[model samples]
Target: MANPDFEDLVETFEFLDDWEDRYRHVIDMGKAMPPLEEALKVPATKVDGCASQVWLVPKIADNVFTFRGESDAMIVRGLIAVLSALYNDQPVSDVMKIDAAAELGRLGLNDHLSAQRSNGLRAMVERIRETAAAAA
Candidate 1:
């Protein structure tokens, strides 16, 4: 399935006035993701330093980088959904061009997250960038 549109995700979050509701929405998004294939799960693809287990696999086709990710925690899975919407099916350069922190803020997610969760998110993004850089 195609990743949800970023704007649509932001709008959906906006509809939830309360943080609790928004969080549930996020978790639901995570649950909505299809499971990653077993073959793609590997140590090298795993995202380190996450509070919960997370694996990220990057694919480059026609110069665009598409990401597939999975997480053990529901909240983390939701976080992956957000990241996927931003980075999936985009060129490596385009993914690198995005200011994820600012974009998350615009989506009203940055301030709501705990420091640990924020750090994990940063780590995930950095890993993706590193993967892209290596591919480049």
Candidate 2:
């Protein structure tokens, strides 16, 4: 999908004067994520190092990569939404060039994140990049 959702998220965060509002917005994004099929929720797709269970399935077609993910926790699911905005349906070249931590910093989410959340988020990024590398 051609997700323009990240631009909306950035604009919404800029409009909100407080981290509380941004956090709420993130949670809302999580609420918007499509439900993953139970059949795709296998151990191999699970993201390790996350406090909550996360499953990611990546697909490549016509030189573009797309992802589907889900998380048990709302905030983590929001983070996955952020990833979808950043990574989904992108060319492998674009995906390989991204600095996920830097992009997440643009969202201003990391400083407020708990240590575990931050670590899990980074783990997700690593997984994405690794998948991108293999696809490339």
In order of appearance, the predictions have TM-scores of 0.91, 0.93
- In every candidate, how many clashes are there? 0, 0
Q: How does residue 94 of candidate 1 score in lDDT?
A: 73
| Candidate 2 lDDT score at position 135 | 77
Per-residue accuracy of model 2 over 46-73 as CA lDDT, tens digit each: 9999999999998989989889999999
User: Which candidate number would show the highest lDDT if scored against the true structure?
Assistant: 2
How displaced is residue 24 in candidate 2, in Å? Answer: 0.9
Which ten residues in a row are the worst by lDDT in model 2?
1-10
RMSD in order of candidates: 2.8, 2.1
Which pairs clash (backbone N, Cα, C closer than 3 Å) in model 1? none
Q: Could you give candidate 1's per-residue lDDT for residues 1-136 as a string of tens digits?
A: 2235877887787887899999998899899999898887889888888988899988898888888889989999999999888788876777777788877887778878888898899999899888888877
Model 1: how far residue 39 lies from native, Å = 3.2
Give all candidates' CA lDDT scores.
0.85, 0.87
**Model 1 scores what on Cα lDDT?**
0.85
Q: What residue runs in model 2 are displaced by over 4 Å at the alpha carbon?
A: 1-4
What TM-score does prediction 2 earn? 0.93
